[model samples]
Each structure stands twice: as structure tokens, then as C-alpha cells.
Target: MMVEQVEVLVVGAGQAGIAMSEHLTRCAIPHLVVERSRIAERWRTGRWDALVANGPAWHDRFPGMEFAGDPEAFPGKEAVADYFVDYAAKIAAPIRCGVEVTAVRRNPNGAGFAVTTSAGDIVARHVVAATGPFQRPVIPQMVPHSAGLRQIHSADYRNPGQLPPGGVLVVGAGSSGAQIADELRQAGRQVVLSVGPHGRPPRRYRGRDFVWWLGVLNKWDAEAPPDTKHVTIAVSGAGGGKTVDFRRFAAEGITLVGRAEGFQDGVMHFAPDLAANLARGDADYLRVLDEADAWALRNGVALPTEPEARQIPPDPPCVTDPILSLDLAKEGITSILWATGYALDFGWLQLDAFDAKGRPRHQRGVSAEPGLYFLGLPWQARRGSAFIWGVWHDAKHVADHIAKLRGYLDYGAPAALEPL
Candidate 1:
């Protein structure tokens, strides 16, 4: 028996879920948004204190509301959380926080879903899995465990002071790993940054933020997801936005190492791919510069030239001849911060709407199984589909689909997402 019913049910009250509610309300759809914890809980808890939004303020906001402060400044983690909270309040979204959806199953007797939650069971005609990406933290299975070294995933990392008084080794070269390692080293701790496959995008180009360049070039909406999903971005928003230069880091004494490969008694081994990885990243940086310059020339957009935009140096000797192994005790490294990224977990979704790798199988978030949808997936619709502004567009598209299904309105042919 259904205790309650609604036209649409949105899961996870993060930016994606909240965006869904906004569009649903606009379409006059009767729905409710459910969150496992408070709205934007991850932003409030799962991030480091020193973290800032990866995108600039002007580019990463909803179309309706403006973020307070300088438009070019990157809002800190707390401010970003507050922005979502304020957006929810402004829309008067019908949201119920603390209602955790444990399982979702198709209604065997009808065209709906039977959802079991911490609050109560409810039947929804349409279910939107707006859980977003970054579902679960993933550490490599090969990472050895030892009581001597304090190990924690990036989600659990709060600050450099949270760790013991010793050197720190941050594994992975993504945004989170690089930021954390920089913090540790700035605090006078010996830090080793494990290099991996990463894209080095310049923070600024041609007197404008790189984000502006991406929008004008349609790189955000025009690009498609690559075959290898392991490539993480190397950029920083600490003091405004800046390129993540490993060469500069090496010059600054933040030792660069290869990907973490092995661990033994009080020791960790790395691959000899530091030079290769840096070379790959340098190539990526050059490619962006080349493309941006060409685009300007083609469009005849005469912008002020940025000098450092084309001044990336080759790898220094430190980056080329990196330490292949680390004896933790000998190096005085007492902490291992794993910024290894996340894995998808749809264990509660009792639907065959996923591929073999557990990635959602949906065409622009509309599942093959009718009435089921996914939102806020990375590259679900395009490169920008996972960003804050991108989520707004995706949610509106989904809401339009729901409205059209119930004869609310007609939705035209939107952009077709590529098949995964």
C-alpha cells in the first residue's frame, strides 16, 4: 500500500536535485525532492575547508539567480553551499530533507515506482535519480593498509592540521589531490604528489578566464566524453584561478612522483611514468593554447594577448628524475591522502539501467525504462552537462519531458546526446 503519492520524485537534494525541483515547479508539476541529509550536504561536510569552486563565479551559476561577490572570484566551499541553500529557499522548493531513499522498484501492478525510504513508502509516477556523480569514494584495492600511516580519502580530508605532525603523500594528480598536496607543503610539510593522467587547462587565456573561452568556443556543450574516463583536470581556484603547473611545483620543492603502484612494509612504490605523465599534460596544455589562438584568429576577435599563455616550460630535472619508491618512515611521511576519485553505486536502484561498468545507460537522462530518469551525470548530455549551469539546462530538459508525457505541453527536439 502506498502511504503517499506524487507526480515526480527527485532523489538527492544537491544542485542537480534542487534544479530539477525548480523546473518541475515551473512546469506546474506536483513533485517532492528527497535528500538523505540536509540539502547540499556534501558541500557542507565532504569538502576541505580551503576548497573553492573549480569554476569561476560568472560561469558556474544558475540562469535565474546571481552569486554574491565579485563575478570573477571563485566562491569558497561554504559560500557555494550557501548559494544552493539560498536558491532552494528562493524557489520555495517542496523539498523534504532527511528522507533517505533506500530502494526503488517498479510498481509491478502499475506504471509507477515503489520507493522505500527512511520516512515512508511512496509511489511516484516518475522517478528522477538526481543522485549526481561523486556517489562513493574509491580507493584502489592494491593500496596496502598499515596502522602506522594515517590514510583517508579526499572526502574525509578537512585540512593539513587534521593529520599527524609529519610529511604527507597525496596520491592522484586531480584537482583535489593537487590542492591538498599544495596545502600540506605550504604548511611546511614534506609532500609527495603522485602524478597520473590529467588534463592541464590554463586558468586564463587572452585576457579572459578560460571558462569564458570554453563557453564562447562551445567546448563545454560541444565536447564529448572521451573513451578513457580516468583523465582528471589539473587546475586550481585557490587564489582566483591558476594553471596547475607541476614544473613550478617541482621548482617549489613539492616532490613529484609517478602513480602509486605498490606498498610494502612501511614503504610505497611508484611507476616510472612521471616523465611520461608530465609530457602528456604538457601536450594537452599546448593543444588548448593552439586551439584558442586559432579560434581567435578565425573569428577575428582581437583580444589582449596573454604572455604566459604560450610560455609553458619543459619538465625540470626533478620532474624527470622523480623518486620511484618511498620509504614512509624514512621520509617521515605519516599520512596518505587518497584523491583517487569516486565510483558509481546504484545498488538500491533495482533496474537494469546501467552498463557493465555500472555507468547509467540513459539518453540525456531519460532511461530506457520509461518514467525513470537520471540527472547530474558527468557527460550525460555534453561536457557541460555536469557543471552547475549545465545541470540547470539538463533539469529543464527533463522537466519538459515529464510535462510533455502528461500532456502538459509540447517539447521540441532538443540536442541528442551521443550513445555511450
Candidate 2:
């Protein structure tokens, strides 16, 4: 097999990779993007129906193109995947799909790097791990042994139809979990949503879409103040602007419960603070709203109008409705959907640069390892690192640095496509 030589080798060709590819290409850098599967494979394979991005259409788009839908509305998963495919082709990014990067390490001489892939080896002066946050699904061990009921992580779930007919229990109260529970209940399935400590705020307020707020506050601006603590808090937790529609979930007969604790003998256990947690989340949101309102008041900005507040309905039927104990098996929750979360797995890249947390130690996208860089990561910028609208800003910065380091022009033309 022949070796492939490039100045910069970008791994994972999703939103981040595609955006970075465009930046590199425009800057006239010699780079190649390698993806484990075809572009948007995760969105194509991992997502489910009725899966609209929790964010507004405008906020979920890549650089150069705006989302073609109503800016206030959310786009479904298919639309998102299609958008990415179009972005890739429009930019004419040079990406090799179906190429899995098995390992990555720094060049021993410290000038460049080497990557081992299923296709062949590639040596490059720079490596950018643009693999976004959802690299792998993490399931808690306590769930499997604690409950004898069926269990599936969020990754395996494509839609409510895939769930067991019995009372469907969704663990993890994040955006995905909340949305899944809402859908299950809408489908007439007995749904029980387990609310973890982390809660979500509403996407719309008083008929005003959430994106309106984000824009008014200049959350997307590149020159926004860094000390705005409230904006920081809201945007970081706004996973795709995903939040449960309490009124809809409650009206449709979905029960919100405490966090998933453990499962045993077909029993699932939950902890306390279900109501309190929800209230606290609501209060936090209201607090932020009040602050934003107050700022507008002080600065002569317009006041916010009141939308009908959707409160969590009272006394939805619980899995253990008649005051059962914390154990889930006793309540008869047959299947547990561990919607916990995703983790970024960079373990295969045996560079001794990451902290104990397995995150690459990088100043912005430039890692400590010379010629090794990363971009399109969550929180990579002051804002919008993980979202579609956010990654491009970071990508542009990283792409410039890579180009300067390689002394290449603006277009990403590889000096050689074959390995050195």
C-alpha cells in the first residue's frame, strides 16, 4: 500500500469536519479529511424520526449558508443531514468517507504526525480531531444489573415505535431524553421520564422564539463580552435548545420521575427531588428571563411580552402510581432507555498530551503537540462551539493557524494524496 502525505489531516467529516474542510480549502491549505463513514453518518444512522434539532433552524446551520427553513422553526434530523451533505458538496471539500482512523500518534522527530487507518497510513504535519462531542454513548453500569427489564441506550433508539409497548421509561432528563419521552407519550405509549439533576428551559417565550432572545442578547456575536455569566450558563446547557414541553408531556399522560438510580430483578430505582428539580429549573429560566428583561429595561430595550406559561401538569400517573418504593423493578418498568449522554473518545490517539479527563490539551485548536490541532469542538469558542452555527467561527481560526504553520496558501490542495 502507498502512503498518503498531506499538510493537515482532519478526522471525522461531520458538521465540524465539513466546516473545517471549507475553511482549509478557502485558505488554500493542503489537507485531507478522513471519516469513518460517509458524511453525516451519525445523523443518518443514530438519529430517529420526529427528531428536529432543539435549536431554531438558523442557529443549526453551517458557515456560508443559512438554514433555508423558517428561522424560528426547528429542522428535523433528515433536514439537518441533508443540510450537511449540501454544505460539503457546495464547498467542494475533499473528504474520503468510509475511512476509519484506528490510531494517531505524533511524529517521533516532532515535526509532523502519523495516522493508522483501515485504508492505509498517512503522515501529515498537522492533525485536527474535529470529532464533535457525541463520539460514543455512555451507559451506566448500575442500570444493567439493577433492573431485569429491557434496556437500551439513546443511541439505539430511532423512534418511539422501537420502544416496548409497556410503560416506556426514559432515563436522563436532557434534551434527547425529554424529547423522546414526549414522543413516546404522544404515540399512546405509557411513558415515564426520569429527570436527572440537569434540567432544560423552554425554547420559546411569550410567542417569542428562543433564537430571538439569543440574537437580542448578541449571544452569537464575535465581540460579545466574556463576563456575561447568565448567557454562559444558558447557552452551555441549551443542548440544541432542547427542552421538554411540559404541557404537552403532561396533557398526553407522561409521568416525570426522579433520576434513575439502580435496577435489580427487573426493578428500576429512582431518587427523590423530581418536582423540586423541575421547579428549580423553571425558576432558573425565569431568573434568566427576569435578568434579560431587567437589562433591557435599564438600557432602553423593549420589554418582553408574556407567552402562556406551560406549567408541568399536576399528578400525572406514575409507574408506581400508588406510592411504591424507589426500586424500579417493583414498579414493572420493563425497558430502561439510558439516555444518559455522549462522551468524546480520544483514547485511540496515544499522544501523552490529554489531561486525565482524556481531552486533548490545546490552546484553542492548537494542541501542545506541535503540528497537532483540533477544531469544531464544543465550547471551542466563546460561544456556539458545539452547535452548527458556532463551529465555523472556531474552524476559521484553527484553519488560519494551520495554514500559517504549514506556510501554505488559502486553498487546501494536498502536496500529495498518497502517503510519504
Candidate 3:
């Protein structure tokens, strides 16, 4: 068994790992980035073929690297993956692709960590888990074990043609669910979208992208409310900056059902709160808009009075009857797409740093475990911590922390080091 030693080890060569590596290299920190697959594997293989980034290119950039293409346009999944590859090469990040880390545990002397990868073992003074947030798909336990139906997670779904030729029942009304339903319906397949509590932000507000407004309002740094559950935001770039509102799905002949409850006797039960869910999403969206408007007015920022020409009007009430259950075989729903988001998996890491909810206990990227850190997690430090543009900030902090511990000045420090 080959063994190597480094000052730092960064797992997963995605956006987060690459960003962390850049900072580590800048700090003259000896680090190795290991990935189970090629860089940006999720963006390259996990997403659907027609899927485009929810945010435009300008907003979907890393530190020191902006999209060279049209800033207003949203790049497709492949294009985004290619961008990551290019960025990794441009930064000369030390990455070992196709090298999976099987296990990570503290060293016997409590000095650092020992990472056991498929290739060999690596000992590092610091370990940064930059594996990203979406480690595993969150499929509900309510889904039935049916031999007649095909089930696929959003991460595995590539295109409408991959599924069997029949109706599709999307089990979540998040961005992925909405976009997939629309795409499947456009491909001449019937689609039933299960509604859930979501936020339907406009594609563009006041003649500017909604993301730009978010940045202006400083929402990215705003603290999330206490006891807030993750709410999926309904927005998409599949149709080139299109709004994936549930109201429009009803008008487009897509069956809108309530949240999936459970499955029994070849029937899938659902909650009878379709209207309430839609109303909640609408209300949440309006609340955000109101907040943005108020902030703009208070700051004296001029916003366009009229809506953009590309903005589509919200469709009127279409789904009225409360769909309580769906007869899977009878309705000809041959496939189920579970777009219920994802959960973090750190089973490989033998540590007590996780909370009751299995989330790592961290302040920013610094974890409870010394010499350990996490990056690319939703709201890790700010609302955009997991985002391409936001991860850089957290990376810089983690790099500085590691450098300080090792008696090295922060990267790019002056020659004359001041007193600590």
C-alpha cells in the first residue's frame, strides 16, 4: 500500500475543491485534491442534458474567473462542466481524478487525519471536505416497490427519452421537478407534478435578473430564520430564463397534485393541500419582491416601473379538484422522478463533528474537529456559500486558518510580518 504525506488534503475536485486548492497553492500550502471521478462530475453526468444553470453566467463564476461567454445567457450543464475543467487547468490545481477516498479518520497521535483512498493512504496536517452538499438523493420512503413502474432520481435523469414511453409522475415540485415536467410534456409525454411548498421567484424583476436583485439586497449574507426548513425555489433556465411557476404548469395541461404521502394497494396517496401549497409559494415570492422593492425605495435606487417584455403573465386558476391519490397502473404513469433534493453523507469520516441532524458543526468552514473544514455546503457561511462565486470567500478563510496554525503568514502577506 502506497502512503503519501501532505500539508493539506482536499477531497472532491468540484468547484469547491478547486477553489480551495487555488487558495492553498497561493498560500504555498502543500495539498492534494482527490476526486472519485473527473472534475465537475455532477454537472457533467448528474444533471439532465437540457438543463441549464439556474443563474446566468455572470453570477455563476468563481473568484478571478468570469465566464468568457455572454454574461446574460445561462450555460447548459455540459458548458458549466467544461468551464470547471478549464478553470482547474488555468489555476494548475493539483488534482488526482478517479481517486476515491474510501475512509477518513484521525491519526493515532491526534496530530492530523489519515485519508484512505482507492489509490493509497494519505496523511495530511489538515483535511478539507470539499465534497459539496448534494452527496445523495433524498427519495421519500413513501415510494412503493412496484415492479410495473420505473423510478429514477433527478440526479440520474438525463432526458425524457431515457424513461419508458408513458406518463411521468414527478414526486416534487422543486426546480428540477418543474423543469423536468415541462420538458417531458414538451416531448409529448403526459406529466403529473406533485406540488410542495416552494418559492417561485420571477425570472427577471424590473428589467434585471432576479439574481442581480438578490445581490443588491444583500440577501446572500442575510441570516436564515430560526427553524427554517429548506424551501425549494422554483426557477429555471431550461427554456432560456423561464419561470417555473406551478400556475403555468396547470395551464400547460400538466396535472398538479399535492405532496406525495405514501403508497398502498397500487395507489399513491397525496396531501389534499394543492391550492394551499401554491398560495404559500405565491405569497413567499410576493414577500421577497416586497422586501426588495422596499429596500430599493429606501436606498433611492431606480427600478423600472414596467415589467420586462419577456416576462410571462401568471396563469389563472386551473387546478381546482384536490387530487388525493393517484392510481399508478390505471393512470398509465409508467415512471416516477424523485426530485426531492439531497442529503449530506459523511459516513466515511469517523468524527464527532456532526450535529443531531447529521450536519457538521462548523463556524463558517471551520469544523469542530481541529485541522478539519468543510466547503460547498448550503449556507455554510452565507446564503451563497455553496454557490460558485461564494465558495471562494470561505476557501480563503479556511486557507488562512490553516496557514496561521502552521506558523505561516496568510497568503499574499507582506515580507515584514507584524506581531501576532
Candidate 4:
């Protein structure tokens, strides 16, 4: 009923929201961050308990805050949630948890914006949609309604013990699917992983983490094409910095299937592209390694030689084999884990600033809608725009723009705030 006014309103209290909030705080911008649930809700509840950050702690640090423990060690999901909580407190972020934004629209007078939330209505001079890109779980429409089998999205999966006592079919061989299949297999469950196009990078390459090399090669800054499909890299800490590629999965006796097509007549159908997918993945992986090696050599960075050359494992023999369909009952698979990834949902945002695909039309983080902005979106400015370490630069840029717009402070170009 009553309206509250603020200089800026940031929606969502995840890593992106917190990062943007901290920057705004530094700029002395009056703003409030409202979260639908607790801070870092996805890290707290949307991930498996065994899930650790894909990258090391040092690379995952938000601006002005570093991980207190071992920098190279990967922090688990709970640890990540705690880090966000601590970071929020340390920055003194004006955040109101448990408050969900219902709708957001520009003011009729074209002054600022009107933000409707579960708590109350707020008129803000600027609104930053800091909600990360992965907002909704994308379950394939072809998934059949099987009465005997339990189906769950990767976001809802916690552990192997949660599922019934039977085999598991993990659909989609992305990072999550690969890791989940590995976890289930290690837990003594019969696991079958549906193969798909992915990037299979080794956990560590040449005494350095693959992520470190990616950083060195500035791969994170690489711009993706506008219609580029998201590719998930198969690397996890569950196996102690181990790579979870299809070859390794096959070696571990996990059944590999082709891309999941659909379910028909109580049987799951798959495309007969297993060989092509495996070949493509292998080629891409080798290309990436070659590029990294070339970059290191060009930069005159000497890599430590192994006393004994590492023996690369042979490619899995199952690539040529293709299983077109499988009856779940016959295969004894009682559960299906849909690691099919996520799609962004900005339906609540009442603005014409979005493209045809529902993504905000913004340069970096600033939108043409004036007071409207976006943060933590995939390929927003660069390849790493959606990552924890990557969002800070965009946050700083958005904060600087907001401050300048409000006539708070002139911090010159956004490039001036680049990390030292």
C-alpha cells in the first residue's frame, strides 16, 4: 500500500547481486538488495551436497574478499554459501532476505522505475537485475510421464541415497550429468550417462589447473557468437581434481548412451550420433590443449617437464556403439536425472529491453532502457561474464555508471576501476 523510495534497487541476492551491491556501497549509492530466499539460495539449496565450486577458491573470490582457507582448494556448496553470507556482512550490504520481487516496470512518468516486491512497493531511480542467467531448470518436453520412475532435475538432486534402490539414467553428459553419473557409480549404483557435445578439459594440465591456463590464455575474455550454444566443461573435484570425460566414464564401466531424443511406448529413444559426438569432443579438447600450448610457447613461459611422460589413455571403444532405445524397466533404471541445464526466466520484468530470446539488450551491464541494467548474464561482455570472478568487472562498470548518473561521484571510465 505504501511506497518506499531508494536511489537504486537490486533484485536477487546471489553472488552477482552481492557483488553489484558491494560496488554500489563503495560508490556510496543508496540501494537495497532484495532476495527471493536467503543469500546465495542456489548455492545453498539448488546444488548437490557433494558439489564443489568448479574452479579453485582463489579464482572464485568476489572483489575485495578472498577465501580464508587454502586458496587452491575447491570450496563445497555449503562453504560457498557461507562465503557469500560472510561477504554480504563484511560489505554491510543493505539486503533484505526472504523478499521476492513480484514485478518490475518503468514509472509512468518515465522518471525511474517501480519495483513490486513481496514486502512492499518501492520506487527506485535505477533497477539492476542481478539475477544470474540460470534461473529455471530446463526439463525436456519429450520426457515421458513414467509412473514407475522418479525424475528430478539436477538442481533438486542432493545425493545418491535420496533415490530409490535401482539403476540411474543421467540424461545429458554436461558437467553436472558427468559428475552426477560418476557420483552414483561410485556409490555402487548402475549408472548410464547420455552423451552430448561438451568440452572435456583435464582437471590439471602441466602442473597447473586447466582454469589457470584458461586465465593465462585469456579464454575467459573470449567473445562468444550471439547464437552460440552453451558448452559445459567436464571437470569436477569429487574425484579429487579428476577429469570426468566420456573416456574416463567408459573406463570406469559406466554405460554411455547417445543424446536423449524422447520417450515413446515406454522406451527412451536416443539419437545415433554417439560416434560423431565423441569424435567432436575429442577434437575440441585436443584443439584447446594445442592452443594453450602455443600460447605458453609464444609467451616464453616454460612448462615443467614430467620426469616420466604422462601416458594418455586410449579413447573409449564404445563410441562406435549406438543404443537407439532402452526400456527403463528392462534396464532396471528407476530414476532419471535431467542434467539438461537451465534457461533464464525474466517474465516478471515488465520492460521492452529484452531480445527475442528474453535476454536483456544491454552493452556490458547498462541497458538502453536508461535506469534498467543487467548483471551475471552469460556472454554479457565476455566469455566469463556469468562466472563468480567475472561478474565483478561488470558490477564495477554498472556501479560506476549508476553513481555518475545520480551525480554522486565522477570515477572516470569504468576501465579506471580495473583490478590492480
Candidate 5:
């Protein structure tokens, strides 16, 4: 087999990968970017039509290019994909597409890494794994055994047009679930959304975009002393708001259900949220929004508002009307959509240094494994590590640090790998 060598091998040419590539290029670092498919295909293929970004355009930019449109407006997935294509072209970021990196193994002597692809092997001293956290959608075993309803993960869902003719049950109350439920209800599908601890929607804070304020105030920016716990809370609480709120979903005729129980023959059963539990999802979200506002207040930052906030019509009720939970399958509920959260899959990575939860134990993007680094993870620096606009700040830091590493800084030769 022909051998290929590179000084630095950056995997996955999505937002994170592209950002790293740009940084490497600017530093005149010899590097090769390998992507499994067309760049940004994840956003192009995985998202829905009505799916504008969860946040504003200004908050979805990269290192060099700002999103081209109304700063306050949200761009669709296609627009994002197009932006990536143009950005890659503008930067002349070399990317080898259609090469799936199957395995990444550390050199036995602890020098570099071996990146095995379907086509061939790439050896490099420093390996940056930019394959983001949403690589795969996890479907719980509890969902598969549901007796009669056809079940599909939210990843498989493109739009309400693809849902079953019968009423649809959406599991999870995260951002994806809420948006899916809204779309389905708007499409005239009787929709039920299983509630979870979702982040709050900013009803109105100050007079500016909450996300913009977060960005300007450096809420998602990395700090000298990393606050992982604070980072997690910031991101998990209100980093990205759901496209639709419970009130609007309710007004749109979407049923807001409590957490799902085990599925029985064709019937998807749900546990009722107690009187106290009722509207808990909305309350939970509002609490987070309040917290965000309080954060701005405490920090003495001017709260910035969305430009179009006043223009957009008043939201429909957060809850859809006549949205009552009925037994699915038994009650002719034919389909289930799991909008549950996503999990990171480092199973193939085979790192022994992971935490008990299988997460990489690291400060920022530095994993315990030497020469192996991760960037663009959710809350990696702050709440912005995963956001397109926010990733650049983190990527710059990671790339700058990587560029200083002994092996990474060398532009002379690709690190050699021993015989497999």
C-alpha cells in the first residue's frame, strides 16, 4: 500500500476542523484535513427545512467570515452548508473527502498516532479529532421494544412531512424535541412532546439579543482559570434557546406530555406531571432565562436585544391547544420521534484516560493522551465551544497551543508509524 505522511492530520472538516485548518494555514503549518464525506454534510443532511439556526446569524459565524444576511435573522441548514463550502474555498483548506477514518491508534512508543482510513493510512505527530459530539444519535433500548408504534430517532427525522399519518409522539423536551413538535403541529399532525429539563427561552431581557450579549460579554469565552462546572451550567442552561417554546407549541396544538414511560403494544404511555409538575418545563426554562438576565445584571453588562424581537409577531401559546396525551398504539398512535439529547461516542477512540462517564479527562481540549487533542466540544471553553460562531474563539486557542507543541510545530516531516 502507498504510504502517506503529514505533519498534522486534522480529522473531520466541519466547523471545528475548518477552523483548525484555517489556523494551521495561517501559521504556515504543513497539515492535511481529512473528511469522511463532503464538508458540512452533517448540517446539510441532518437538519430540517424550516430549521433556521437556534440563535442569531451574528452568533453563528466562524473565524474570518461573518454570516451573510440579516444579523438578527437565522440561517437555514442549507445556508450553513453553503457557507462552509465557500469558506473552505476562500481559505483553500485542503480536504480529502470521502475518506472515513475507521480507527485512530496511538504509536506503541508514544510518539505520534496512526489514523487508519478506508483508503489508506495517514501518519502524523499530532492528531486533532474534530469529529464533533453529534456524530451519532443514541436510541435507548427502552424505545426499541415499544409494542406497536413505529419509532424513529430525531436524527432520522427531516421534517413533519416524513412523519407517520397518525398522530406523532416526540420524546424529549430538549431544543430538538421542542422544534420538532412545533413543526409537526404546524404541519397538522397531532403531536405530543415528552418534557425534560430544557433550557429557558428569553422572553425579553434588556433590549438586545440575549445570545449577542452573551457573546459580547464573553459569557461563552474561555477564561484563564477554566471553570468546567460553570461552563457546563452556562451551556446546559441557556446557551442555545429552543426555536419554539412550550407556550407556542401549546398554542399551535402540540400536546406537551410528561416524561415517557415504557411503551406497550402500539400504545406509548406517559407519566403525568403532577399539578406541581404541570408546566414545569416552561417554568424550568424561564428560571434559566431569569438566571441569564441576572448574570448580565451582576456582571454590569448592557443587555443587548434581538433586532427583530419586536418585529416577530407575539408567539402563539407555548402549549398547543387540545393537546392531551392519549395512549399511542392502543390509541392508534403509529409513530414515535425521540428528540432526546445527543451523547458523545468515543468508544472507538480506545483512550484509557477517560473519566468514569467515558468523557475525556482534560483541561480544555487537552486529553490525558499525549499528542491527542479535542476541540469544538460542547462547553469545552465555555458555552461556545460547540457553537459555530463560538467555536472560533476556542479553536484559535487550541490551534495556537497545538502550534507550540514540539511535534505539532514542526513543519518538516510527518511522524512515521511502525508496521501494523
Candidate 6:
């Protein structure tokens, strides 16, 4: 096997990897980005058909690159993928697609890393694991295996038609879960959205998008939450975006249930916390309003005052006293969309920088293990570290560190594609 050597090796071609490449290129550092599939592969294939970026295009994009048309418009899933593809080309990123990294181990001879990939072995002075979050789709263990119910993770869900005939039970109220559930309901399918603890930010508040409010409030750079519990945000970008109101959803006949507890005797049980979950979500929304209002007062800018913190549709019966359990067959729910989210899997990287949870122990992408680095991890640096706008800062920091390494190898020529 031929061993390709480089100054730095980037293990993904997604936004983080590309941003890292851009900064490295600016710093005149030679590096190669390898991807398991094409650039922005997840955006291209993983998300559902109705998926749109949570943030508006202007906010979601990389610096100096702009998504054409309305800046506030949330780009569709395919558009986001195309944006990455175009951005990679713009930087002329030295990326090899269709090359899958199987494992990574320290170079036994001396320093750096020995990366084993599908194509061939590669040695690098430093390795940046730019594989952003969402590595593995996860369904909670509490969800039982029922013979008739087709369980689908958000990653595999493309459209409602792809699901088996009958109503849908979307368990989990995260961004993906909430959006998926709403999409199903809008398609005229019966949907029971299981509510959970979540951050509810109104799509438009005080004559500005949520992105603007977050920016003005400096919430983007806020410290990442201590816990790694999956971030469940009740916000949407469908139909030009709207405030995700579970009350309205309940009032409209979509059943709102509490968190999934367990399964017994062929029935899925839900917790009795629907009202609490809804209140928490509403509280988050109102808190945003309070902060925004305070900031306006301090700045002496008179913004439209919402006498009501936010419009709260009357609490429906489903939210107050939710259904505790439902037999899959009896409820006519043929499919269960487990938007429970993903758990990061770094099992391939033979490094000691990770905690017991398999999360890299890094101070903003710079791993404790010298040559090994991580980028685009959730809360890797700040609240924004997980998004495109924030990941660039982390990438620049990592690239700058890599630039200060002991030695620099000459830029290697691009490798020829081998027949797989």
C-alpha cells in the first residue's frame, strides 16, 4: 500500500473540513481533506426532503460566501449541500472524495498519525477530525421493537411517502423531531408529537429573525451548555419559517404527548410531563423576549413592545393531560420516527484524548493529544461552535496552531484516483 504523506490531514469535506482547508490555504499550509462521500454528503443525502437550515442563509454560510436571493431565506437541504460543494471548489480544496477513513493510530516510528483509509495509508504531521456532529443516528433503548411499527431515524427519513401507510409517531421534540412531526401533520397525516425539554425561539420576534435576536443578544458565542443532552430546539423554517407553538399544534388536532418513557405489553408509554415541557419551551421564548427588550432599553432603541411576552395559544387538553401510552396498532401509527438524535462515534481514532463518553477532550478543537485535533464539535468552543458561522473561528484557531508546528513539509502533489 502506498503511503501518502502530508503536513496536515483533514478527515472530512463538510463545512468544518472545508473551513479548515480555507484557513490552512490562507496560512500557506499544505493539507489534504478526505471524505467518505462527496463534499457535504450528509446535507446531500442524510436529511429529509422538507428539511431547511435552521438559520437563515446569510447566517448559516461561511464568510465571504453568500447564498443568492433573500439573505434571510433558509436554504433547502439540497441548496445547503450545493453551497458546500461550491464553497469547496471556490477554495480549490485539496480534497479526495469517496475515500473512507477506517481507523487512525499514532505513528509507531515517531510522531504524528497513521490514518488507515479505504484508498490507502496516509501519514500526516497533524490530523484534524473535521467530521462534524451527526456521525451516528440513535434511537433510544426505551423504544421497543414492535413487529408492525417501522422505526426510522431522522437521518434515514426522506419524506412522509417513504414511511409505511398510517399515522406517524414522532418521538422527541428537537429541531429535527419537531420539524418532522410538523411536516407529517401538514401533509394531512395523523401525527402524535412527543414533547420534550427544548429551547423555543420564535422565528420572527420584534421585527427581526431569531438569528438577528441571537446575534444582538450575543447568545451565539455563549458558552456551550455543560450537559451533552441532545439539543432540542422548537423552531422551524418551513413555509418561510414560523414560531413552533406546540399549543397551536395541539389545538389543531395533532396529539401532543410527553417524553417517551418505555414500552410494555406492546404499548409505548409516555411520561406525564407534557404541560411542563410546553411551559419550559414557552419560558425559553419569553426569556428571549425579556432579554431582547432589556437590550433595547439599554441601547435606547425603541422596539415594538409585545405586551404579551409571546403569543401563547390556549393550552389544549392534550397538552394539559396527555395520552400516557398508545398501542401502535390501535392508534394506527405504522411508523415511529426516532428523532432521538445521534451519539458521536470516534471509535476509529486510536487516541487517548476522549472522555469516557467517547467525546474528544479538547479545548476548542485543539485536542490534549498534541497532533490530533477536533473541529465542528457541538459546544467545542462556544454555542456557535456547532454552526457554520462559529465553526470557522474554531477552524482558524486550529489552523493557526497547525501553522506554528515545528516543521512544514512542501506541498504534496495531488494523488491520482485509484480504482476502488
Instruction: Compute each candidate's TM-score over C-alphas.
Output: 0.94, 0.85, 0.92, 0.93, 0.82, 0.94
Candidate 5, residues 1-420, lDDT tens digits: the string is: 656767778888998888888988887778898898899988888766666676667667885788886776667888889999899999999898999888888766436777788889767777887888786786777655536567788778887767668888888766667667766777778877777544444533565555755655556664544434321111111223433445555656776666676654444556645222334434544554556667777878776643443232433332223223455655546788887656887665755547887777777787788777787777776766788876767667777777787554356875445534
Question: Candidate 6's C-alpha lDDT?
Answer: 0.85
lDDT of residue 172 for candidate 1: 92
User: Tens digits of per-residue lDDT for model 1 on 47-149?
Assistant: 9999999898988899989899899899998898899999999999989999999999887656588888999888888899999888899887665564478
Local distance difference test, candidate 2: 0.70
Q: Which stretches of candidate 5 lie over 4 Å from their true place?
A: 144-146, 203-206, 216-218, 222-243, 274-325, 407-420
Per-residue lDDT over 1-420 for candidate 2, one digit per residue giving the tens place of the 0 to 100 score: 666777789999988899889989998887899999889887888876667776777666764887785776677777788888888989888999999999887665434677889998888777889888887898888754444567788888987767666777787766677767766766777777777555345566645565566666665554433233222121221233444544346656777777666655555567766665656676767765665666567788665566445444554444224222344544556677888877778876878778876777777777887777777656566556777867887888898887676665335863432343
Clashing pairs in 1: none
TM-score: which is higher, 1 or 3? 1
* Model 4 CA RMSD to the hidden true structure, in angstroms: 4.9
Model 4, 1-420: lDDT tens per residue? 447888789998998999999899889888999998999999988999899888888887786788878888988989999999999999899999999898888776436777778998788878999899878998988766655689999989999999999999999887788889998999999998898877777677767888887888888899877788787667787755776667778888898888898897778888888877877777766766777778877989888743332344665766656678889888899999999989988888898888987777888889978889999999988988888989988899999988777663344532111111
* lDDT by candidate, in order shown: 0.86, 0.70, 0.84, 0.83, 0.68, 0.85
Q: What's model 1's lDDT at 185?
A: 80
Error of 1 at 253 (Å): 1.5
lDDT of 3: 0.84
**In model 1, what lDDT does residue 278 have?**
84
Better of 3 and 6 by lDDT: 6
